[model samples]
Target: MILAAGRGMRMRPLTDTTPKPLLQLRGKPLMQWSLEALARGGFDRLVINTAWLGEQIGERFADWPQQHPGADLRFSHEGQDFGYALETAGGISRALPLLGEVFWVLAGDVYAPDFLFSRESVERFVASDRLAHLWLVPNPPHNPRGDFGITADGLALNQAEQKYTYSTIGLYHRALFEQPWCDVVPGNPQGTAVPLAPLLRKAMDAGLVSAELYTGPWTDVGTPERLAELQVD
Candidate 1:
């Protein structure tokens, strides 16, 4: 599932007209890079949840299924009913039926042209007892503080001096978003607004989350300047 529903508040004026995911990096929509990676990684089906300017996203990528070999695109339309995005957890809950027992989640706005969505990685995650497996990257200039900490044993922790930014790409087991651990109601058929971080933190406390440090070509693409830099490079 690709989380493309964000309003891109940091992206401002540029995003006013174009959804962040639709913003181009080197003449291609940012989300398209993720699509190609998924395709190369052997993923055939994908669910993209959208809200602001979502119709445009649907229209643009509607043909991805036919364009990318073995790829099938499905949209979890949050705007049709909610008129706004159901935050990450909410959106995933709403799309659970499509996601099944476990799924890969990626942020649509990030620019990780070299990130490979490997089948072996998925198989490893699926075989683990962990509820979530996150890829953490070295802190970029914009977010120097970073997000989560990883232990020697590869467990994700909330507090640690040495932390890494979450790549926003992860393997998630459905149990992390279901009852007992999660209380956020699903957002499809109906809609709800819920953040994803708190849910992850809760799971972390239970030692249900695992993580790995990823040193790769990646950019958050959170601002117009960063987009411009990518375009220039």
Candidate 2:
């Protein structure tokens, strides 16, 4: 699932007219990079959660299936249903029906050109007992504090002296949305907004989350300046 529902407040007027994921990076739409990567990794179906100019996303990718033979693209319109973007977890929970038992998720607005959505990684995560496997990146300038830490055994730490930023790329199990880890009703009928950190932290405490440091080119294209940097690169 590609998470594309954010309002992109940081991007301001640029996002006022276009959803952040649809914003241009290099020569194509930002989210298209992830789509092409997933397709190259042998993933045939994709689910994108959208809000904040969601219709344009659908129209823009309407022919993606034809462009990539065997690829299936679908969207969950949070804005149309609830009038705003449901925060990360809420958006994921609402789209749970389409995601199935295990899936890969990444933010559509991030620039990670070197990241590969490998099938081996998926198989390894699926074989593990973990509920989620996140890719952690070195702290970027914008997020110097980082988000979480990893132990020798690779379990994600809720608190640690050395922390890393979540790359927003992960393999998740459907069980994470069930009782104990989360309480959001299936399909998020109430359209309740929920962030994913709380759930990840709770799971981290239980040793149900694992992570690996990803040292690759990555940028959270949340602002015009950051987007410009990528364009220049």
Candidate 3:
């Protein structure tokens, strides 16, 4: 599922009018770039998860199947941000049904990048018993502390001190979210913190995880300047 519903506080005026995924770069919306990559990768069925200004973003594809005939594109509109925006895992929890057993999970903020990233990278995970397949990128300055550490064997490491930077884009299975999906305590304002790295690492340590690292062109456009910079490419 394409994650498109973030409230991009860092994206300022651009997000003021359009959702971050809809922000233009290289002559197309960011999510459009991701969609195109998915299409190129032979995936036609797509489910996008959205929240803030959900209607406007959903309206962009009011007749998506017609615009991109033969493609099965659908949207899941998350309700208003009454208190705090749903955390990453929370968003995934809410849309678990739409995603099914195995599907792609991607960040909307990143510009048009190689979605396939390296089918080999994902193949290892897909072949394993892991609940999720993660794409780990080299550490960048923005996330100096990183999130998940990786060994040469591609096993994920847990640490109290150091962590590896993980690209949010990934492939996930239903088992990982079963607990969150069924056990959510209604009216609990403090949402569950479902971090992608820790969960994947646990699966790895237990031999139920799968992962790979890619040195390809990947960008996490969390800031306005990075968003603006991608436009020139």
Candidate 4:
């Protein structure tokens, strides 16, 4: 699942006319990079959640499936369904029917051209008892405090001396969005907005979440300056 429903409040004037995911990085839209990467990685079925100026997203990729051959590209229109962007967990819950028992998710607004979505990684995560496996990166200047810490055995930590930023790339099991782990109903019938961090933190406390360091070319691309930096690079 590709999360592209953010309002991109920080990316003002640019996002005023264009959704952040559609903003150009070099010559291609930022979300296109992720889409291409996923297709290359053998992930043929993709669900993109869209909200702000979502019509443009649908129109932009209308012929994507034809272009990609076997690839199945579908959209979860949160704006149309709920009238707003449901936060991470809410969006995922709403799209649960389209996802499999286990799925890969990444933020559309990030830039990680070199990242590989390997089948081997998926196999490993599927074989584990963990509910979620996140890829953590070194803290960028904008987020020095980082998001979560990793133990020597690979379990994620809620609080630790050393922490890393969550790259927003992860493998998640359906169980995380059901039962005691989460209260949001499948499809989020009420459209209650929810973030993923709290659920991750809870799972971390139960030793149900794992993570690994991702030392790769990555940028959150949350600001114009960051996008500009990528262009300069």
- Number of backbone collisions per candidate: 0, 0, 2, 0
Q: Per-residue lDDT for 1-233 in model 3, tens only?
A: 88887889888877887888888777777778888887777677888867778777788877777877789877766644333345566667666656667778888777537657445645665677767777778777798888776666666665525565778778877677665333443322345534454555566666555556777777888888887667675
lDDT of 2 by residue, 1-233 (tens): 99999999999999999999999898899998888888878997999999999999999999999988888888999999999988999999999989889999999998888889998999999889999999999998989999999999999999999999999999999899878788988788899999999999999999999999999899889899999988988
lDDT tens readout by residue for model 4, 106-206: 99999999899999999999999999999999999999999999999999999999999999999999999997988999889899899999999999999
Best by TM-score: 4
**Candidate 4: regions farther than 4 A off:** none
Q: Which runs in model 3 stand beyond 4 Å of their true positions? A: 80-84, 117-124, 160-163, 180-182, 185-198, 201-205
Among these predictions, the greatest lDDT belongs to: 4
- Measured with C-alpha atoms, the lDDT of residue 58 in candidate 1 is 96
Clash pairs of candidate 1? none
Runs in model 2 deviating more than 4 A are none
Cα RMSD, model 3 = 3.5
lDDT for position 12 in model 4:
92
- Candidate 4 lDDT at 30 equals 95
Q: What is the TM-score (0 to 1) of candidate 2?
A: 0.98
What's the residue-level lDDT of 153 in candidate 2?
91
- Give TM per candidate: 0.96, 0.98, 0.84, 0.99
